[model samples]
Target: MTIKEKEEEVIEEFSFFEDWMAKYEYIIDLGKNLNGYPPEQKTPENIIKGCQSQVWLHAYMDGEKLIYKADSDALISKGLISLLVGVLSDQTPADILSNKLKFIEEIGLNEHLSPNRSNGLSSMIKTMKAYAIAFSK
Candidate 1:
């Protein structure tokens, strides 16, 4: 699917929860499904700097698309990363750079997260985009 279509799917999935509590629970559940990151890859360079929790993100170009994989010491953070990876992975770098990922706002994720977690989320996005930028060449 296109990135926008993937984003819309996320918004739709999140819409199933009427309250933030249920939403958070669902997010945690999503976190459980992440493919574990390789322990050896948890180096300083892979670590996202701004997170209160240790969040590790990695991305690379596969043909014309970017493939992202990540992990976090924190459950919620992992879920948040999963949400982002779901939407943004397997897409072109130019496409990723041009989109705002407004679905984060659309899902009210920004309002529900703690300030530190919010910053971590932003850092993760930045890290993924930075990888895309490098490989886009």
Candidate 2:
């Protein structure tokens, strides 16, 4: 399925969980399945700033869409990054630029996150947006 379709599916699945903890667990599990960067590509250049845990992200344009790979030292954070990337990857620059990831707030993760995590999340979003901007140019 397309990333957008998968994201909608996840949102639907999350809506089925009664407890917020269960939703968090589901997100973490999603992260566990993400394809991380190769050891060789794990460098400062690719590292995402503002995250409490070390996170690395890389993006490349494949035809009309942006492809992404990312990793984090912390398991839950890795999952968070994975979820973000999963939702945003494989999208064309214009689609990504116009799309708003309301799911973060819709699932109520934003209010529950620590200040640092929120900063990291913003940084991650900035990174993804920056990639789209650069590729579009």
Candidate 3:
């Protein structure tokens, strides 16, 4: 789906649930829908370092915008990465670099996550954002 449509869907789902349990479930479901990366695409070159879970991410410039493809071995981690991609994919590198992922906190997920999980997610996001910076340079 288009980012706008996905955003609308997220907002609508949030409107209905308004509770963290429901929101977390929705996020997990969203992750379940993440497209898988072919074995060839999940090469060492594409691997995102520092995540506790195995993550592979590839980013390329499409015209003036950056597009991303990513995956992870762990289920919820995959979903978390999908959530990050949903939040930042298709936008300009500059946009991705400028806007903080404030939604994680706003959604009340950050505080509930274990310290290690939070760090792993942070590392994944940092790698993605760093790629945007690299591509934009």
Task: Give me the runs in candidate 1 sitting further than 4 Å from their true place.
Answer: none
Candidates in order, TM-scores: namely: 0.95, 0.90, 0.82
Candidate 1: tens digits of C-alpha lDDT, residues 30-127: 78888867778888889999999888888877899998889987889899999999999899999999988989999998998889888988998999
What TM-score quantifies how close candidate 1 is to the native fold?
A: 0.95
Q: Which ten residues in a row have the lowest lDDT in candidate 1?
A: 33-42
Residue 127 shift from truth in candidate 2, angstroms: 0.5
Using lDDT as the yardstick, the better of models 1 and 3 is 1
The full ranking of all candidates by TM-score, starting with the best, is 1, 2, 3
Candidate 2 overall lDDT versus native: 0.83
lDDT of each: 0.89, 0.83, 0.77
Candidate 3 per-residue C-alpha lDDT over 1-137 given as tens digits, one digit per residue, 9 for 90 to 100 = 54445555555556677666777777678667888566678888787777777888888889988888888877778888888888788888888887766666655567877888888888888998889889886
By lDDT: ranked, best first: 1, 2, 3
lDDT string, candidate 2, 50-86, tens digits: 9999989999999999988899888778888888887
Predicted model with the maximum lDDT = 1
User: TM-score: which is higher, 2 or 3?
Assistant: 2
Model 2 weakest lDDT span, ten residues long: 1-10
- Model 3, global lDDT: 0.77
Cα deviation at 55, candidate 1, in Å, is 0.5
